[model samples]
Target: MSQRRPVPRLAALDGLRLVAALMVVCYHYLALSRSWGHNPVTVFPTLHRFAEFGWLGVEVFFLVSGFVICMSVWGRGLGDFAVSRISRLFPAYWVAVPLTALVVKKWPEVTSIRGWDDVIVNLTMLQAGNNTRNVDDVYWTLFVELKFYVLMAIVVLCGVTYRNLLIFCGVWTVAAALAPSLGFPALAAFAMPQYAPFFIAGIAFYLMRRFGSNALLWGIVLFQLLLAQRYIDYRMASNLGHVAAEHLPSWPVRLIIIAGFAMVGAIALGVFDRVQWRWLCTAGAITYPLYLIHMFIGMTLIHHFRDRLPAPVLVVSVVALMMATAWLIHRYVERPAGQWIRASMKRGIEDVRLNTPARRKARWRPSLPAAPEERPLHSAGVH
Candidate 1:
């Protein structure tokens, strides 16, 4: 049996995450013209062409999440896993939710808040499940991420292993592929048919990375790569709203998806394991906060300034502003708050464990008690 290997920190994935976030940023800021009331295609004739495809970044993010989440929970208990996720997710998110609400309240340009009720639900990050609105459209991805996390948590409970992961990836992939035909809403919801391949591929890549690539792992990656293309239209229709397939060539989108898998596959194969740069850490840290806060806040800024500044200049300024804000939130808010949340949750878990009924009985029961065992009505010899 192959044991789990101590995998080196792949700093390059951190860099890749920032790259993915920036892609989504560009997609939101430049590809769509409705937000700023300017034709982005004309304003960003060259860039808009590329930005149109930037939404693929979300797919990249899922792939990365698959790899990272599986890697993160490998040896950790469910309690530690929960703590890490809560601390890592909520610190920046708590700030971003209301901050985004405030922006929508003030601007109401690209999107708007329904009320404080919506804001409250968004904070829990279960807005999608509740059928409540997301403060920013980009937040839709967070719900997808949350679902993936829940599924991975189950894997952690089952114990992460090379064999177990193989079984998980196989079962999940089949369920996702069959979800629509099964005509089950809950199944589709949990299966996440459109996004499952990316996560599955990611897990497979991690298996390759940890256990070394073989025919089976490579086959899983290839199968997912093929299966992933099946959802391109659905993703485009849903995520891009009115943006039709005819507007963007299908070939490039297919190529980009392939490229995404290839990039992560290269990482799994240790092609770029030596490419660790200290700066990649900073880039990774800001990615989530940046993804959270960039959309509505950015569009609001562009709404006011699009007429006042040159198009390229305004776009650059908005991206810069978002990056700066993301950095500040990461440095000032996430680090300290994450530590605090981790400590608090740990204490809370300890309290729960100590106060359980079993523990309570053990703590209070007398040591002297030894009840006599009852004899059967018919003794063995008599019977």
Candidate 2:
């Protein structure tokens, strides 16, 4: 058997994760303040303008997820990929769900509760599909991420090859682009066609890096760029409207999108491969836990201190506290719990194999029948 090539830990990508997580944190800190009937932006107009663009962090995240997920499972089997994803996502998520619910329950000012059934659905991470409200609004993205995983797993199971990926990306992009117009609104919504371009961009980067850049890879990248721009235009027009879209300073938003795309391109082209910073790995490790836990906890803190402290100070303090909480969860809860679950799963699989009839048959062997036949033949000759 040929040895599988090991996937490199892209330190630059790890750093990007930290930046993305913080952007989301900042965005939520500002947006959630408004929900609590306090407009931090009114006090600090400049900061609010900057934070408004922070929602773009999610787009960056989708791009990173696309690239990193493909890289992580490069030579891995479907089963291995599934295990890795489950271990990474569920450990932090399971802990966060209850913690978020508890915070919301205790401090209803940050958000409201629809009851324990909603909490139960949140645990499944399919609350949207089940018509249950999320404890925190940030959870909608998790549903998108889960859907992406399912699609990627399908691609992996089919086989990960240049030609295969090309077809998959092309077909998916077409489906996403046309789903809304073709009476399949659910398809477009569930598959998140608007975000598909970013994900495809990530996949294109992976193909270029691993398989070596070619015309096909470049074509995919170009196509992704066009699709991404289209998606952005649509989003801005729909969400902000033509008047606000034109009036609002969109330079920051444009810069973020361009920078995010450029960063992925640079990494794919090997520009950042040699930049090894171990701290980035730590930053990446805590991002998931941070994202999961930050919204409710940070908002609650802000609600408590909004009147007592300056808006900027309150925001900064909440961010710092959230970061610390993320670190603690990553080190204590996520790491240990993931390790235990994976180990237990491995042992359970082994036990099942040992107990299987097929495996038992393979282990068993018949005694040499020839020995008895030879003895009988010798006795007959003597007689």
Candidate 3:
């Protein structure tokens, strides 16, 4: 039997989720709207294009989700792990999809699903995805994350030790880079291209705590960020990779842009700024709901009125609406639902424990039939 390690607990980790969720919110702000999207590095005469690069937020969400969830199961058996994950994931997502469908009719395309197929794939949460397009537009990475979950969970179910998990993730991370050339189209799918490394990096962090890990484990993050910027030049520039060879002469700019994507993750988790706000952290609590709702409401409100209102004030109102709406949903809806599901799950677990047959208590029995009781002790004392 494999020995289990103590779970790594960190207060700051919750804050990371908030950061990730907020980053995703930023990505949505850039997405979901034609006029106000963000592109982090606009080409000449396109400085405002930074808004479209918000999709990076989704990538960040996947990395953070994989990392944290894997850590949750680090030393545990994989038997019930997948079930638990699916249970938690499907409930919220199932509730959200119909609502999303109501937002805009599914965009029909050869790449994306048109009517029923999209719903089927979206409900199953298994669209492998093509190019930058997505089911529900925002849900592509969820499927990718779920796919990774299933794959990694299966590996763990077969008794892959933590040490083995480390080696596997490390190897796989490197392999994800070469995936497109290797012809595993799934590996190079645009929505989730070559992202297992970032997620795996989080897994390695878990194993580091389980076994003895050094400062270098942390340094990997630093190195990845610096290398991405200085050498790769592949930041959130969507199609920049195509023109990368063309811009070989402009390697310096490429390096910096590439660095942005890498550093984006590091800084997101407090690598860049030391945040100490209770309320901003409070906003992080509602960050998930905020992420889901912010796109449609915030963008529509902003786009229609940005021309009328000051940009800074408009930005504030959008953020304020997002926070307020998220809090209300979280307080009245998301929290209650999460609590109910968790409570029901807890009850089910307890029921399972209670229903399991009690171990039959060993009863006193004669080992040997010939054995007999001695005469009364009172007679012996009188004698």
Candidate of highest TM-score = 1
* Per-residue accuracy of model 3 over 42-159 as CA lDDT, tens digit each: 2112422433344455545554565556555644555446545655566556655555555444321112234655666667666544333333545655666776776677667755
Global fold similarity of model 2 (TM-score): 0.85
lDDT for each candidate structure: 0.85, 0.77, 0.52
Per-residue error for 168 in candidate 3, Å, reads 1.9
Whole-model lDDT, candidate 3? 0.52
Error of 3 at 159 (Å): 3.1
10 residues in a row with least lDDT, candidate 2: 374-383
Error of 2 at 228 (Å): 1.5
How far is each candidate from the true structure, as Cα RMSD in Å?
10.7, 12.1, 13.4
Candidate 2 residue-wise lDDT, 178-286, digit = tens: 8878887678875677899888889888777765678887787788777777666666655445765677865666678889989988888878877778788888888
So what's the TM-score on candidate 1?
A: 0.90
How do the candidates rank by lDDT, highest first? 1, 2, 3
Per model, state how many residue pairs clash: 0, 0, 16
lDDT tens readout by residue for model 1, 67-124:
8887777767789899988999999999999998888788787777788998898889
By lDDT, is 2 or 3 better? 2
Model 2, stretches more than 4 Å misplaced? 1-8, 31-36, 237-246, 249-251, 348-383
| Residue 154 Cα positional deviation in candidate 2, in Å, after optimal superposition | 1.2
- Using lDDT as the yardstick, the better of models 1 and 2 is 1
